[model samples]
Target: MHNDPSNENGILHSWQQNAEAWTNTVRDGLIESRRLVTDRAIVDAVLDGQPRSVLDLGCGEGWLVRALATRGIQAVGVDAVPALIARASERGGEFQVASYEDIAAGRLPLRVDALVCNFALLGKESAERLVASLPSLLSEDGRFVVQTVHPLVACGEQAYVDGWRQEGWTGFGTAFPSPAPWYFRTLASWVGLFAETGWHLCEMREPLHPETGRPASVIFILQRH
Candidate 1:
């Protein structure tokens, strides 16, 4: 019951506070179901693109960076939370403490062959800005891939509409910091955002959970026109 929308830095502060726990959970394979299914789907699509390098935007603990590097693909990670960025740096990947806002302003300092965001696109405002900047961040044939909680699956009992909702953080433990504010956009809204932001939706996929046979997340592959 500690929700405070007035705190502009709430999301960043929460991640900063929960960085160690978050890193540990991810590295320990706490969400292994996602790592095995959703992550594999994304990595497969990324490799199919055959990019020389990639930008792992909002990369929490650098897992994707390391994964791509193992394939002989260079990847750089960027996160707003310094604590997370520090942890990612320790994992032997190039990382920077840059916010999505900085990336929107063309300050990434490097253009990548591809950009991937894994369950990291949070707020609608920030997401729109980042989408607007994708053209500049990617090479001509570069593709942008995003894997996130499916609106249908994540909405649960809540109304399937565009708005902010709190993440459960169940796997991270109750001791974890404030739940991050996630913007819920319907499937149509997601498609609309891509169209309005100048991206062509090349393909879409739904990664299903092995046991439940329900979508674990939605993946979108987009490109600039």
Candidate 2:
């Protein structure tokens, strides 16, 4: 498999070593916390009983995949880390241990009605490669929905304290502490990425807190042309 120097051995090795504990912590936290608005919006948009097949990319621990399956959608989850895939499979979701680049090369066995990527695609080159592959992975008119750390937060241009708040979650608590090169762009950048990848941008939303009404995330929906 081709490897990018920025995302090579160290990052993967770190995740592999700590994957079990990391996945459990993440899973427990998400299960207890209230749903993020962006997550709800993504689910509302695509879980309309139409798209039977769905692929959850970078599906760590498969929470979203299981949620989709509970709604009767045929969902499969895939991630590069072996431990994460093992946990996902234990949850009754089909999980594959492979990167998006690997899957794009025909490593996976099935295509789907839609693709969902949730806070999973980071790093500039990797995101670009995955965005470039979405069109071919979907059925005609297939939809793609993604939730990511808002560009402002990820880029360090905007702080999480300014809007959405996570009290105890330290930014650098992950197994990998150093930041990888991330492409956290404004709306135009997102549109451009989809356009360059041959997918048409359909809708965009900046989800906000229900009470404070402060912007928390940006969600994008794209349709295969």
Q: What C-alpha lDDT do the candidate models reach, one value each?
A: 0.85, 0.68
Per-residue lDDT tens digits of candidate 1, residues 1-225? 232453335667777888888988887777766667987888898998999999999999998999999999999999999989888888698888999889999887788899999988887778888988889888897899988888998889978888877775886533576676667889999999999999999999998898889898999999998
Q: For residues 44-69, could you state the per-residue lDDT of candidate 2 as single tens digits? A: 76674279999988888888888888
Cα RMSD, model 1: 2.2
Question: Which runs of model 1 end up more than 4 angstroms from their true locations?
Answer: 1-8
> Each candidate's TM vs. the true structure?
0.94, 0.80
Candidate closest to the true structure, highest lDDT = 1
- Clashes per candidate, residues 3 or more apart or on different chains: 0, 0
* Candidate 1 residue pairs that clash: none
